[model samples]
Target: MFHIAICDDSEYDLQEISSALQGLRHLGICFDETWYQSGRALIDDIAEGEKSYHLLILDMLMDSINGIETAKAIRTYDVSMPILIVTSTVQYALAGYQVNAWRYLTKPVDPGELVREAAAVLKSQEKSDETCYVVQSNGTVIRRVPLADILYFESSLHTITLHTMREDIEFRGAIRDIDEQLTPLGFFRIHKSFVVNLSHVRRLSSRSLVMVNGDELDISRARIQQLRHALMDEAEREHISSHRMRS
Candidate 1:
């Protein structure tokens, strides 16, 4: 099963996409779709904390944060999720290219087409599941963790603890050593004591960030700007990758 986020200001379209996705279940493509009334509401949820979605369906024309801008904001934190554009106008279709929209569907979307596009995304995720993150624990204990399941890593004094979706695993290591290894895998050192999985960041204040599991971590002043830039870059790459997928 996959989770999807759909954002649209109009109530009619929201229900339409929801119904369309629900119909896909018969084809064995299970999806749990969460609906948002506006782009801001969706982004607000994202900014508030880690509600993960494998895909996004956005409306092009909306008041205040339009779909493209909303998608751009999402791109800053998530670079690979598929984003589908739903609109009544063809003129807005090309604009989606800038946001790396996975596919564009005109108003009154065909249910069959939606199912086909969604199944394509599911097939892709199935092909990528074997990748894992291997790390050492307790000096000699080796652990192979699914990269996506890791929540964050906390270092206190000399011990490092991996807070994952499954459980907390503590081992002897320096934060810097793991930081060097995980940074390339979307981890960010927001503070000296914490290196977080940015994907798990649910909300942030001026001084701290709350992870998906509700644990709050301090953000050092020195790394604040760096963290913001990294998130933005992640979004940019996400949109770019969507285009590549289509190509």
Candidate 2:
């Protein structure tokens, strides 16, 4: 089930959006929603880790903190949740991109359009769930991180550090084990100390690889040819997936 949060100062608009989202239930897109009359309340809840949401529907204009400002604050903590901006004006549409908004809808929203966008957002989340990597510690699941969010894994002996977009997580493990597990999932052991997620590799040279986060990692000479082939296969797979999604 999906968890959604709607933040709007206007009660009428909030109810309208909620009503539109209800249509998703008929399409088997079940979700639980929370309503917030102010952006501050939503931001605080997310900041305190009191709640987690799959999607956020926000109104552009509000009393103290506007939708754009609220989104910026939330991004500091959660970067992957989809943000959908609902506003009367298009002026803030470009601003929404800064927060990686999924889409922007004009006020007096068409119920059909809103439902379509909401469904798409939830569908994408479903896809991401399939690629999530569960992190376990001491036989207990500690975290469920999406593989797409991870940049690379750095190993120093038995300690494996997960370098992600948000932060780094250190755990006791061996790089070889991780490489064997993630190899089929678009990861390559570029060096004995590092297994890089090809999806997050921005550039590659004979000697090293540049990650999306701007960190450079060495590529072992023996693995260069294999890494290049892995990258090519990954690109082809991504291209085919994109085409299928569009069709």
Candidate 3:
């Protein structure tokens, strides 16, 4: 089940958001909601408590602590949690990016817009559940390798090799099929024969990717732009996740 936290100083605004979330239940979305009056309260709970949430809706303005500052504090402990900033002015919208907020809503928030953003976050989290790739090794031993452990997939002559943190495993599969399963989970196809996990990319050059495992993979000339975009996106995500672990 998805857990959501809403923090707003204004009780009226809080009620409005709560009502909108209730309406989502009819559309088959299930979630647990928690409300906080100040940003500090919510931040403290996350940092000090065991409860984990999927999303956070923060008010951009508050007397004690503003949403942006709260989001920054949260980033110090929990980076991947999706944050949606609610503001009455557009000026704070750009500031939201500093905290790596997933999205922002201008007040008064449209219920439909909020629902759309929430739905997108839920879908992304669901995709994250695809963390393992099942393959038959040597045509007999079945294995389920955690996707995070895999550095990259090398394809040649219709035989695919999974280069992981521990060892390499060879299997028969189509590169296209591997791409279909992993691309959505942050793996990038830098060349027709190589698909690298963005999280495992340690360095990048004009024509190659240096993986964390010390393997250098060639980047296709045609996929340079796509690879760059994927790297930037992955860096932001990794920044958040690492902070969470450190905190």
Off by over 4 Å in 1: 132-247
Where's the lowest-lDDT run of ten residues in candidate 1? 135-144
Per-residue lDDT of 30-54 in model 2, one digit per residue for the tens? Answer: 8988999998999898775556677
Write the residue-wise lDDT of candidate 1 on 144-166 in tens digits: 46677888888889988889876
Candidate 1's error at 44, in angstroms? 1.8
TM-score per model over all chains: 0.56, 0.59, 0.54
Q: Candidate 3, residues 1-247: lDDT per residue as tens digits? A: 5678899999999999988777668768888888999988888877753445667888999888999989999887666778888999999899999999987999998998898888888778656545667665343323446788889999998899999987787878889888988999999889999988998999989999899989999999999998999989988888999999999
Superposed on all Cα atoms, model 2 deviates from the true structure by an RMSD in Å of 7.4
* TM-score between candidate 2 and the true structure: 0.59
Arranged by TM-score, best first: 2, 1, 3
Candidate 3 residue pairs that clash: none
Question: Once superposed on the true structure, which residue ranges of model 2 sit more than 4 Å away at CA?
Answer: 133-144, 148-247
